[model samples]
Target: MSFLPYALAAWLFFVGLYGIVTSRHFVHLVICLGVTQSSTYVLLLAIGYRTGKKAPIFTSGVPVKVGAVDPVVQALTLTDIVVGVTVAALLLALVIEIWKRAGTVDPDELRRNRT
Candidate 1:
């Protein structure tokens, strides 16, 4: 119902994009990418949120007629987080390898040194 969460997600996404655009080091770039990816979690939570609804889990006392939040959204958010962490780890490993070989993590320096 409210637009605040959507606005926050958009703000986070843009901030991350700006950081990525201005980043000089590979590690910093990877961190920015992670930040950008986090916005999706906020967006997903917002979409699944219900003003007065209960969680998707149902118990004996809880009536089936009562509204429940979307479980699929929660699942997707969890999956997204897992994928993001995996991607971040892989990117960080690649950055470490680059640093080991190139002696520098700066993108501009890498470009200059590239054959």
Candidate 2:
């Protein structure tokens, strides 16, 4: 069950990457990034859901013997979210800049400007 989510997320991310790479529209690329991010978040939450573990809050009256989910992964997910947002923001800013400078959002056009 745990591995299923991870596999699905991996597959979804692959599809998103394919779309992003083949996409002719900048909007489609951004949407694919969001899709990839959501799959990763789903995978993270699924991994965190163990069989019968208590909350990870470390309360005073908890008596469960199950191992808590790795807080490192949780923190990583949060950091990933922040980084994803930052990247999307930057991409949007770049798109806006491109539109202002070239009046087009085609990746091919942007690449042509490189040389």
Candidate 3:
């Protein structure tokens, strides 16, 4: 197994984490969170990948004896993507509400303006 995908996933995770930690705006923080979650997709795909295997779709031409990539991993990745998008949408809505109330999207300013 190659280590490139794993390394790439780690790099993406760390970059997103750094962005989250340094984020000032609520929208930016949400975007960074999405970026962090995307690492899981790469990791899952890497884990399920086979060098020459076909997708887990069985057909008349493709016999069951022939190995296929894991379907569970692909399903999980799709689920993760859906959940991430949902969460990002919710967070964006919250940010919009916060901006309407406080006239600012900066987290630091929001904290200062808190009642």
Candidate 4:
């Protein structure tokens, strides 16, 4: 049970890498990049997780020194999600432009036309 998250993260990373490697279209490559970024979020959350800790919050009835899950990892993951979305959007836009100019989204065709 404890190892599930790690395994999932690794799987996501590998799948994304495989997709990227075998991708033929620029749009498919952009989507694969997103899959790769999702693995980091899972890994970060897994690393910061506490087995039986409370949320990192102050409450009147709770003990002042009770163990709380670290909030930094959650914060970082949120930031990463925002940045990743922005980057994915930019990449998609670039791919659209490439398709417009090249008349095709195939990577091999684009490379051939670049010469």
lDDT leader: 1
lDDT digits (tens) for residues 35-103 of candidate 1 = 899899999999999988888987798568878989899999999999999999999999999989989
Kindly list the per-residue Cα lDDT of model 3 for residues 63-110, writing each as its tens digit: 587689989999999999999999999999999999998899998887
Better of 2 and 4 by lDDT: 4
How are the candidates ranked when ordered by lDDT, highest leading? 1, 3, 4, 2
Model 2's TM-score against the true structure: 0.77
lDDT of 2: 0.81
- What C-alpha lDDT do the candidate models reach, one value each? 0.93, 0.81, 0.92, 0.90
Each candidate structure's TM-score, on Cα atoms with residue i matched to residue i, is 0.91, 0.77, 0.91, 0.87
How far off is residue 54 in model 3, in Å?
Answer: 0.9
Query: Candidate 2 clashing pairs?
Result: none
The parts of candidate 2 lying over 4 Å away from their true place are 61-67, 111-115
**What is the per-residue lDDT of model 4 for residues 1-115, given as tens digits with 9 covering 90 to 100?**
3999999999999999999999998888999999999999999999889988877787799676668887899999999999999999999999989878889998888788889
Clashing pairs in 1: none
How many backbone clashes does every candidate have?
Answer: 0, 0, 0, 0
Give the per-residue lDDT of model 2 (tens digit) for 47-82: 777766655667679765776766666877898899
RMSD of each: 1.5, 2.6, 1.6, 2.0
Q: Model 4 has how many clashing residue pairs?
A: 0
